[model samples]
Target: MSAPPLSLRWRRRDEPLPAVAVAASGAVVTQLGADALMRVTAGAHLRACVGREQSWLVVLGDEADLPWADGAVYLGWDGGLLVPTLAQPWPCADLLREPLRRLTKQQTGLIALLPELVLAGPLPREPLDPARLAPS
Candidate 1:
């Protein structure tokens, strides 16, 4: 099957990740683009991307902040697309993975969000408080 047409909708810095309902096409979003939506930072600019059948909500940030987890796929700075092993049933993540990869690969500008050199950048660390990480 052909992949759904890709578009981006930027979320406000204070806005939380789009919920499952939004990804299910139950909600309406107006904006659309193929560019880097917003900068993501650990302190002030927390961002997330939610992809449904049509649009993707993405935040551009330091490549280091993105963990190469089970379901997470990283688009490279060299315009290479890396596919992750489908280890689990992450329906929403799976649905958008390839499309997001394609978008990032084609639009190499998104990779520019990460700095060529980061001086003592924050390493990817686990949260000290696990309770806050739990779902509300």
Candidate 2:
């Protein structure tokens, strides 16, 4: 099968390694080209190539934070193009995993990340306490 067409965000290399790390663990990404991302700190964004059937994400390490990149172009496992920055948790994440995995195995796509703030949505109308935002 043919890989998905390549599209890069502006200044992908200029971005910090932390952003890349976020991408690795945020979603199902696969790296394309040579494994030249070793210089990137652990859990970096890891490279990938867009495949025909799937958009693969290279697993670098654990997700340091939210994986959504402001201008990043993500192809979900189901052929959905998502700018993860706008992704909502819950069904959105679960829905995306399917397409992401399927596409990765086929297209082998690559992702360059730009970190951003992510607000986890609460269940129903029960607002979460700010104190619980992080472990003290």
Candidate 3:
């Protein structure tokens, strides 16, 4: 089978989502993690991405975009992070990477999911020119 198409979305907190269009390169992800989200946004040169709570701004597209057909693994929000239930499904192992499993409850669950996005392969790392990113 082929992989589902993925999408990426970002916005500053407590503000309206700008109508900015991204390149067709398909940078995208979920509770959407904070660190991973900030990293990408920072790379995109969104000002102040790392300065505030960014989890909500980090929408890795619809939750449905996740490989739920493989099956859903129950996770919980503990302390400030997402904790998986003991009944972990082996098939969906890709959903939980090493960094996520090691996160302390004190941390945001969003931070754990960043490595997976990075490991998905190299993204367009060249700095984006601000002029090309003007909102429609």
Best by lDDT: 2
Q: Give each model a TM-score.
A: 0.23, 0.21, 0.19
Task: Estimate, for each residue in 20-117, the C-alpha lDDT of model 1 and write its tens digit.
Answer: 11111112212211111211112422233333333332222444343222222333222221211211222333354455545555333121111121
Go through the candidates in order and give each one's C-alpha lDDT: 0.27, 0.30, 0.27
Expressed as tens digits, the lDDT of each residue in 34-56 for candidate 3 is 23334445443321111122112
Clashing residue pairs in candidate 1 are: none
> Lowest summed lDDT over 10 consecutive residues: which window, candidate 1?
112-121
Q: Which stretches of candidate 1 lie over 4 Å from their true place?
A: 1-46, 53-59, 78-136
Error of 3 at 56 (Å): 17
Ranking by lDDT: 2, 3, 1
TM-score of 2: 0.21
The backbone clash count of each candidate, in order, is 0, 36, 2
With candidate 3 superimposed using the best TM-score fit, by how many Å does residue 1's alpha carbon deviate from the native? 45
Error of model 3, residue 98, in angstroms = 16
TM-score winner among the candidates?
Answer: 1
